[model samples]
Target: MRGFDTILVVDWSAAEGVRRAERDSIWIGAVRDGMAEKPRPMPTRREAETWLADRIGSEIAAGRRVMAAFDFPFGYPAGFAEAVTGASDPLRLWDWLAERIEDDARGRNNRFEVAADLNRLFPGTGPFWGKPHRDRFPDIPYHGRSRDGHGMAEKRACEVASGASSSVWQLFFNPTVGSQALMGLPMLSRLRRIEGLAVWPFEPVDDAPAVLAEIWPGLIEQAVRGREGIRDMQQVARLAWAFSRLSTAELTDMMDVDAPEEGWILGAGHGPRLTELAMTAPDPMADPPPAARAPLEPPPLSNDCFALPPGVHWTPVDEALDLLRARLSPVAGRETVPAVGADGRILAADAVARRANPPGANSAVDGYGFAHEATGAGPQHLPLIAGRAAAGAPLAGAVPRGQAVRILTGALIPEGVDTVVLEEDTRTDGTAIAFNGPVKRGANTRRAGEDVDAGAVLLPAGHALRPADLALLAATGVAEVEVFRRLRVGVLSTGDELGAPGVDPDPAVTYDANRPMLLALAARWGHEPVDLGHCADDRDALRAVLDGAGTDVIVTSGGASAGDEDHVSALLGETGSLAAWRIALKPGRPLALGIWKGRPVFGVPGNPVAAFTCALIFARPALSLLAGGGWRAPLAMTVPAGFAKRKKAGRREFLRARLRDGRAEVFASEGSGRISGLAWAEGFVELPDGPAEIAPGDPVRFLPYAGFGL
Candidate 1:
């Protein structure tokens, strides 16, 4: 039913050196056309990357769609992207780390040092910790747990869900998994960027032909019910064999989970469901949803006033973005415009070079043109040619023997000339030029097609054009460009107590903050923000405004929570669909995600602080998706706390704070209604997903408002 025809599974490792006999070397297993292939093992990570690339490329060439799963977390904790790369996009984090990590074909590596470098970027000791080998890194510990002077001692959501999966920060400790993440992520980054390969949950569905997701071998181990295998390769083979045997319907359902940012483990809660569905054959005539499909039905809502809705699960912040990402499809309208006028537009299709980079051999430097062998090994003088060749002009005849042409930079090399002598190295008279240096053949010239070959892709779809990219388009002779239509976002505000900012205020009313803020933010991010204006708690008035707005997506700032005045929920329940509400977040718990009249509707909390937080955390990424730019997690950095604080367990919290003298200082109050707190604070310091006490120097994740496009 789906497109995938070949499935590849990798049991990844971070061990260094030739590991042919080592038990932890990388192992690869594949399934094609119901056949289980023998698992292959590689002694080094380099060889493993090469092998998988070749195999996947070959399968694609044969007209078979492939699904590749690797055993590693595709992303770090949510704030990681903003802190490390100063961008909210998670893929940028991958590219940043990939550029820094060095992997050789041999087994040698510096994974420990890499982890230490990453840890140093945060405040205090971590977000990443546990270094058992050396005491060189003062922030990291040589044990599994964090001490009073260190970071939080907890696992990520997916790690805890796996039951037996190790923490990604444990490097060289009791359970050493830190190396795998530090080393493996770089390779995963390389794999994700492959032309036709797409990394699952992170890359938008339209980015690639095949999807790559995270896999946990423990899921297979459970599926087989602890079947014994002589070696890890044998175990991998068993896993691949099991995957190959699943029916198309079962496999499709298993991979249908919403996992946009923090990837879902395939066969994870659905092992039993898959087994049950496998017995029923899929109808060939009924077309199934494509890969990376969104949930079709709204999850049930709970009747409780302030708690989570019934059957509505509270996903991790990053995982929630993934869900929103699935429901969003890029806007389809496109326009062709002159390349010079397409500066900040998203490319609607790939741009290919029509001609080669250098139509012929051209000089790289300004020098005398001559054949190197024509002169002896020592410095020699040659007669000056009759003509001079400038960058745009060329000499019509070839250089004669014992003669050289006076050439300028970028000029095509004359026939019979293989090298160029620098003008500074030669003394030229009226008829003769004296060479003062030994000349090398084939030097100072750029060969044809050296920079860019004809028919090569210069840019891909969804690329936002930059100044340099415009220059490149000019160089490629691209006169007209195709780009996606600009996204039109509608901003709505609902509350009886709110008034417009510019007008004279009523005695009992507050100036409407959410609409103006969201409008300014949308405009700043290059979207056309349509102000749908404000409505009281009246549902009919809200519906009237929404009907007339006629924008691609809608964002409302009040009436999303569980109060009698919360008409946004009632309206959506009557005429639209409500997907989720009451996320497990502090100051922003009462958020809602749904669809209205076939368009996505995001409901922000009534309190200005919560409204701002929800808009930044949720609405921003959703709009980015519709703009064809894909999802981006807000950037978060680890900074030391300048003040002490304690919070209850279970709920994630964001404390408005300012960075001062290398530490994050929280605002005096935690009330969500304080509008000045949002103004006074430069960013937010995030508490973990449980009860925690923060000392004056504890490391807290600092999320700058700028990272969210505020």
Candidate 2:
């Protein structure tokens, strides 16, 4: 067997509409080696198809062996397919159903109808039934029950063997899994047709880059019961863990199981082995394979490459940003808000100009308005008109011939008058005005629609509104604007060595500084931060809090590094999912990213300085993405290095610094635990990746704390 590189577990769904990482919707869990990568969600089956196609292509191109598992059964009971579709072979049946199933991206699916249609070929009621809420699929009966001498309710061999699993024919009762099967098998059929991918048990697994298989989460779920956190997430994690830890002999034995028509579950009869392996396995990050441990070239941007070997797991900052981009997308909900109250909100749609800036031509200054060519030469005078045009009050009648109107600043220009002469340049009498200075055409005259035109986009979507943007909105005369809702962030602090400040502390415990700092930072960014309190270095307590934290994203400050007291990473790998990112950056080195209860969670180091640095450098941009603005690199400017210092190579460093005498100055201390360094420093002086000698007057990149929304 090829060294398995990637394992993808998809908990398929028959429900309509895009859904969050909750129950009954699509949650795709993937792992490289033993580490769980980010699981992508698909609102509709069509999106899953498109995403899987691209992902499979990318994985194959990267020379990786991939195993993808879907939760639904791949085949029906032995002879029932032949009775209905006249096909004895399951692949033929797959094709027959794939061509007839109707589903769309708009949450419209004919799963019940397809089931009814297939049941029409059978004798009495059905092997599949369950009337939908609307359009009650009337061609066939809408219910199914096992009756004496009935052939339709026959159970598949696998379903009978796995006592906890649901039967394929029970579409309506007892867990209602038939809908997933009816809707899922057709998609798998389409996937099997792709080149370089093989379907398990049916297709012989050779050197194909990816192998598709059927999985029943129950087989392993029973062995790993009584665990906290989300059941579905744990099941997926266990599946990935069990599959990755399988020895070559055990994997071959699983593949060689005998199943004529019905498919065997991937981990059947190996529950004890999988559970033991999951419980007693050594740390996956302890010792990596030679390929993973080998020093390779710097990783390309994530947009250019998606997956890499586990040994060389530490991603460059640029590549990490790219991977974050791949993991996050803008939220989809939009709301109409009053322009007056929309300040500090992100625009969901483009704000267009309702009308032109100036309704008509107006005077630019307080002066006499007259036709430019009416005065032929200098020192010429014209008769003053009786009516005057002032701001907000325009003269109604047209200008008389050989006459000039007294117009004030911002007043509309009189009809047939195209120029304004300043009062300082002309002497005015009671009845006539004298012009002495050189007069030119269109002097000091404002044109209509100069500032803005109707129907033009004044501000595009994804723009964060500022005070100036509100003024622009008011000028555009737009009463209401569409904007994205603010993101809800949950802040958690972990470790038995932490407690609230000002409280009596244990002899060995310190104050909890990271949570308060994170919460304050999130609030400063105009986001809603929910306090998730604190958790000790215990998995059960952490799991309880994680299962109940309902925010859009989670930020934790501790238990991320690979230490014995680091229970967060270990628990995350067991319950939900986790990916350890050994980022090549100073101050913040160990970063953990994963999904818990369907929401994104970020785990930073325990040190206050390191936690603060990681939150600003990584979490802020991720929050921006969740707020629908997408990711933005920290704003950096080149400034002169105020102090000289020698630095090492390999990792990039962000030293606490402030501008002094027009040059950036570094703080004296470089320790990550120094909280005073953050308070005293105004910004950071960023060092490059490689070693270099910095002297006075050398240019260095400066990143202000304000740029990170501090």
Candidate 3:
């Protein structure tokens, strides 16, 4: 009463008394003015029936709408059983039971007398009631029973009808008791009649507070409050709580209830509890979060920032690729030129044919050729007229009828001649020619422009020259082509301890590995690599080398760090400007970016391993940008761990590893300075910065050499 506006507690055993109690509860709780007073409960089934009849009669007399909840099962049980058994008529089974009860109670004086009397009045027909017990009811044969019964059967009819009509009544069973009862016998049979009601097998109840807390706090609270004013309120409250708890998704699923929408408000209060319920409700229609967003910043240019010691750079590999794509996008233009044999390069513009292939009609092979009339229909020997028609020669004269003329391969076919007899198929007889076989019309003739027309387009713009393209262009008389300018990249190694290969080694110095590596790398990308030689640990010397490099990009190694002998950073600071330094990464953290003499300069760390890793990670993207090409790193794969280690988060780390037993195993010495570790490594394992340590059995992402721009 304190919580709900109206509450109805159904009690079918004492229908009249329960109805009165429900009416009183509703009357006491009503606050609205001019509301009709709730009626008292009828004390017995007879009284309840009389009250219903009287209420309906009064409603009809007054012309008013009357609504009420009943305690009968209605047709629900039969409907339920019909659905389960796929039967056409489940009520027949109920009638069969009624008949059996009546036959057993015919003379017996007991409570079953009512049940037995009802059965005889409703003898079942149809497949649902297997041939009614003939011997038991021998006096009343099974053949002539009515579908709805009569006389003594009419009493049984009430009970049979009660089983179905009683369905509407079970709604008030103490939730627990009602649920169990509905799961069994007569009530179950009645439930089967309700259209589209799904019922699952009942499960035993358990007192799980966590589950109760999540599912039914509202019901529990209501039941607790109901105890203050009602008899057996605690029992009802517990039953309500159990029923609410049992209303699980699995049960609702069987009931065909749609899951609640996610993020929807539930209940009337605005607090954490209400929010929790709303959040916990299953959401079959919830939409996924929007796809992860990318930065709106334009792709970084080579001269954007310089990496110095202690500065943070946040560009990811994807961003780097985007920058390269932006810088390397192609410009629109076209040009056309000669392409013959292997000389055809990519066409810069559409080319129109200047002349047709096969300049004039001619013979395709050598033979004594003439019109069919000149050779005649019958086999006859004829004079061989002397007339030459080579590739560039015209026929001397038309042959007379019954006479043949001499012609060579690729010679023009004489006018008025439609065929040529091969020399192998002819013989000389008394200075005359004789054909051994018949010649077809248009034989051995090459027509002008058979392959292409003079005004047609020979090749379109942007077509890469292939061998066949070359031949076609040559045949079409195309002579020149325009193409994109090749990109040039300047390669330089920075460090007093570094020297070029083949140079005498200084015990304290090492040969410059970055130069040769960069050269080969640049060449692979279609750029001309200019070697600027090695720069000593002098700022002026490095600048002088950079000034004269004249390359679109300047890549240097060994002087990016802030060490005492490291001069690349000082050189960049004094000569030009630094863009960014020291990205949030391990191993190859010391990186320098800046512009020198209007050219982009990247100072990679000097350690052999570090330099190579940084080149693959950073320089490759920068180079792609300079060369007018897009960049993309290969994909990473998940592999089993080969060893164990600890790592910190916030910075990305890479370790040299090898595939072993189908798993990626880390090298013994993973230090960046250990070149041998890299040499022995087949790939790299990426480690995210975190407090969690990786164990031997932990799975990790392995980046094979192919994935790292190798």
Candidate 4:
């Protein structure tokens, strides 16, 4: 008993002969007293337009609120083209004017001018300008224009319909056209035939009766209870009764299957059943229980434990980062060094200003000045005095009452003087000065301690030396500063297969790119890079070289994998300790993070591309953390895909890509091991572990080079 009571179906075809064609007619069906009904068919557009106007006008006159749903775009007016393109052509006119109006409103901030322009271009006395509403629809869809316009109109209608006045001027449109218009505007909320309900890019059409019945109940309830004054309550009741024949909830169950977890609720009447279901089949979408991780234990450092292969120990990424940070702790002790000119740096100890920036009161301009009390309100020519004060020059003494002193910029103002009259603004009378303008107290004066008060914090610890800092330190009379000692990093390119530049590479060896890259990176980070000669394949030799390198950190390449030839892990076990050797990421999975002789060391993969990727992802962040700088997450942007692809789940992957037309297109060769792939890529497209496959036109997250520590 939930079907529409009154349904008016109107066929909006142009010819009456076409209206007779049942298939082409737009029907408006109504049930109880024009409450709700199915749509009827109308063949002619003229008939449909007349019927729609009459339906809207009648509903307004009867004081019965009607929600008129239209198939065409209602927000954009027909004359909107002239407003958007600034072009006037009858042939290019659209049936809807809302889109153009919205564009105009957004593009111009002057509402008065916009309204005037719209009025002049689209002049009509009808509900929608003088032109027929259907003639205003756009011929071609502008990107997001239709959708944006519809959303704006819907918000306005909903607000008025639910406002304090209970206004009856509410209108609704389904973006779907059918015979339902005949039921009049009252049936606006009853029409529920929408296509692709669960999928995106929804298309609107007259849904089947079976599907309509499922949505009819909600539509009827919303219409009757949502608005006041129904023209035909009896018809609505009958329609509702007919709709009850089908179980509306069962057919629409899929629509609510993936409803968001936040707004979901179980019926109070079915509490017991809900409880049983909750206990038997827990929802995966529900919140999960928090996991309690085991406390970390420091690696054992006994003489026996360092004998050969060290036992494997697992640590969380955060904990491992913390350990590395503590090992590479910044120098706390500070030593004062002579600060000369622009060479002054911030002291480790907080410094207070020994004196004010200006040292004393000063004159900000060159002029004849005197105390306000000394010069009366009436015009008087004061005798010219011959006292001079320049920057750093102390004033000889205060000028007598009617006498004025000459002052210059940055020169300390004499005592008992409050105002200064510019030399050009006065006519000197020999030994006396005459001023026509009135003078105010404290004018043209720079007070002592105005810029920096005495004993104020001039510079703080850990602040880098800058030009301004040096000037302020000089002004404060500080001769030296104390700063934290810079860290020294040892760069080692491991493996017999690697060779330094300038040296001729053997037929079987490759030039070591890691050494130069690491050297430049360490220098950029304010750390001194000490290159340790490459280690040979022999494990004992590698261990000896690592132990002898006297550096805060030892960054090496290769010899970290489980292969017998990879001897860096064994060397670390013999020297210090090995932390983690593998990570849950692509391209750089074979990364080795460890410590050597109390110094942090990173063993990157042998592949040049893999080595750089690992450095960007893990090594850079670890270094920043060790330098007392917090870790910074990379920036992510949502972009559309220019191509389609399917990816495996469980492991996150980064694809090299270039952005074009606001869409990201993957590079031809994105193999992680290929150095050319990394070189050609403008940025990386990060794909998370999920079952969703990417399709062309689908939105994706793009990670630019700056976002990934580049």
What's the CA error at residue 503 for candidate 1, in Å?
A: 2.7
Residues 232-299 of candidate 4 have per-residue lDDT tens digits of 23223323333223233531332232212111111212223223322332122232222112111223
TM-score, per-candidate, Cα-based = 0.60, 0.56, 0.39, 0.47
What's the residue-level lDDT of 393 in candidate 1?
Answer: 97
Given candidate 4, what's the lDDT at residue 71? 24
Ranking of all candidate structures by their TM-score, best first: 1, 2, 4, 3
Model 1 weakest lDDT span, ten residues long = 297-306
TM-score of 3: 0.39
Give the C-alpha lDDT of model 3: 0.48
Using lDDT, give the best candidate's number. Answer: 2
**Top candidate, metric TM-score:** 1
lDDT, model 1 = 0.71
Off by over 4 Å in 2: 1-309, 505-507
How would you encode candidate 3's per-residue C-alpha lDDT over 31-72 as one tens digit per residue? 101121222333233333333343333222211222222222
lDDT of 2 by residue, 1-710 (tens): 54466788888877777665565557676666345544444556776776677666545543346789988887777787687578667777888888888888655777776777777776655666555543466544455543223365466777776664576765654466787887888888888776679887777785566898888877665544776545566666667767887877888887776774677777776666767655542322232232223222212112212233567766787667656755565543567789999887877655778977776789889989988767776578899989799999999998876789999999999887999999888888768899874688889888776666565556645667889878877876888987777777899999988877878657677899988899999898777889999999888888899889987778988898778878778876774467788989998988887767656778988889988888888888777866766454566788999999898888888899998898999888999878899999988888988897899899999999987766
lDDT tens digits by residue: candidate 1, 1-710: 34355678887877767785736678887655444554566767887787677656645533345788877777665566677789767678778888888877676777666777777777666656665455577656666456343344455556666574577667765455667777877887887665577776665543344678777666645434433443456445555556666776876676666654455677776555434432232321233323113232223222221223357666566456555655455653566778998876877655667777776789988978987778876669899878887788988989987789989999988887888887888888868898765677787888776666665557655566779888878776788877767777889899888987758656787888888888888887667889898899887788888788787778888888767898887777675466546677888876776666666678888788898888887777777766765555566788889999988887789889999999999899998888899999998998878889999998889999887756
Please give the RMSD of candidate 2 to the true structure. Answer: 23.8
C-alpha displacement of 75 in model 2, angstroms? 62
Residue 537 error for model 3, in Å? 1.5
